[model samples]
Target: MCSGIEHGSCRVSDDGRLVWAHVVLGPEEDWQECRVVLDARDGRELARLPLDGAASGSHHMSHPDGLHMGLCVGMGQDGILLHWARRDGEELTGRDLDESSDRILMDVHPGHPGFLTVEHHGADLTLHALDGTVLAEGVPEPSDEEDPPRWDHSCGFVDADTVIASTVESDEDPDRPLHWMLDARTLRVRDAVVYPTGRVRGHVRPLGDGTWLTYDDGSGTLDRWTVATASA
Candidate 1:
């Protein structure tokens, strides 16, 4: 196990040479500081970049070409900040995602170019493109007669046409009971899957053969399901 004490958020760079880790180095009450550390091949620190402000929900997505990385920065009470990083002559240069709406950014799709999904006021969900354009926006519908649609926290894409999102009925219980798979091209809920485990943080990724790999954080295991069966 790596003993550097990483705070949960981590990403493996496309080059596979470094592991970008997001760390919080302060008390819980205070603003959580954010920084990225480049771990060398020998398990040693190579470089560190401290962010401008403290970030709450920190997520990372690498560029398709793997030469650049996108850092999704979320403020506890304020909103979200998108940071772009690229190699600058042996150094990494970064900047803000844009100068427009700074709502609480929830998650980003790994396969889409400049595609961002955000949550605001804890209930509203919106999708954004690379140029900060709103691609799609809506409120999740109630899952059942007893449970009404409430809030969703995270999302990931399985391919160019599909996205899996987490949904809950209330803030008191954030564990998503239903995993929704939406059509990216249509921005409509195509199907819903009842997780065998209770509320969990899960991500959907394609496996190249009409299959998907669902990583359920709550269960600490991976579940492979065919798109056809998962949708049915």
Candidate 2:
């Protein structure tokens, strides 16, 4: 049992071997902070690290390897927090990829040690190696042709070769928000897609087969989407 579970960040690794969470250290309003790595089966606390100067930790994604996990302060920050599951007490690193700031962790590649990040909205989408080298970045055309579109905050890998993302239109038809399939390496838009629903700020998660999931706030339900369906 953990306290402050609602305000914390939590995730279980793909292999089901570990669990990581960020919780407040003290009272509610004065909530001091730290992240905890736990033994998944027994709910034992394996380690905890303090997050100084952060309002609260929110976004968390696990690496496919099960030992590497990424954490973000969930604000418009300049870095991502990486933690090693095997390391002892308070073990973590605050990393900023060479020149990229205000970028947040979106997802980690399943076959590689690298991760993905995008500027606050969908402005600058970049992939960086574990050593901070840029693997690839996006070059989408300007949205000025129509009303400017706002880059979305959620995106992730649908497979080793592709990524899925959303775009919020400011002047374009608001009825159809733009979703995209991008090449994992070159970050090129392979396809543009839309949903039967309206604009929402949530995640596009790959379900390990050919399907993806999105949250439809209007219905308060998880909506399923697929690339094959869109193409047909």
Candidate 3:
């Protein structure tokens, strides 16, 4: 196993050939850090990318090409920064996609040249081009309750054209987190995604294709889902 890896910050490339994570150096109190890329199968070291004095959060998304990535860095009460760098550890850059402190790097579009970000505890989402252009911003419509549902931390791309997002599970509707199907470019609500009884409750993992994976916290069971009908 690779040493000194920040487990929560690890992510695999879309092609499944490489794995990368934030590497903590020296003692735990030192907090000095770098990013290490490794071959997924054999755990061979590929490269070490520098943090350059920036603090990274637990989340990051790698480019589909496996050569570049966006890291959640500069985390603070003001906001988080999207730090960009290549596998070779060169040409580092950072972008403040949104000013919200809760903002995080979501999934990168598998086929398209954009990525997704959520802020304000999932009240809002933004689609950004690879060059940091704001392609679109989407906010969930408030429910009748005084406080809106806030379950979108698991949001991600379902396909190039579709996005999967969720609302916070309501106390009145326990075990039933409503998932929405959205238009990728416009962020328009298309429909609700309904699953069978075998469905799970954890984060949704989109596999680039039309399928996704979910897990049940209570049972520790995992399930893969696909549409069953034209409307689904």
Best by TM-score: 2
Model 1, residue 160: what's the lDDT?
64
TM-score for each candidate, following the candidate numbering: 0.62, 0.72, 0.72
Cα lDDT of all candidates, in order? 0.59, 0.64, 0.67
Q: Candidate 1, after superposition: displacement of residue 20 in Å?
A: 3.6
lDDT of 3 by residue, 95-134 (tens): 4444434567878766867888777467777888766777
Q: What does the lDDT read for residue 15 in candidate 2?
A: 81
Alpha carbon lDDT of residue 6, candidate 3?
25
Encode model 2's per-residue lDDT on 1-232: one tens digit a residue.
2343335678887788778877777776676677777889999887776765453346677767665667666432434343333344456544434333667777876665567777765576788776557788884545545544555776777777778777655324565545778888888888666544445435567664557787756667886777755551
| Alpha-carbon shift of residue 57 in model 1 (angstroms) | 5.9
Best-to-worst lDDT order? 3, 2, 1
> Quick one: ranking by TM-score, best first?
2, 3, 1
Winner by lDDT between candidate 3 and candidate 2: 3
List per-candidate RMSD values in Å.
Answer: 6.4, 4.8, 4.6
Over 4 Å off in model 1, which ranges? 1-10, 19-39, 42-50, 98-111, 120-122, 142-148, 170-177, 191-222
Q: What 10-residue stretch in candidate 2 is worst by lDDT?
A: 75-84
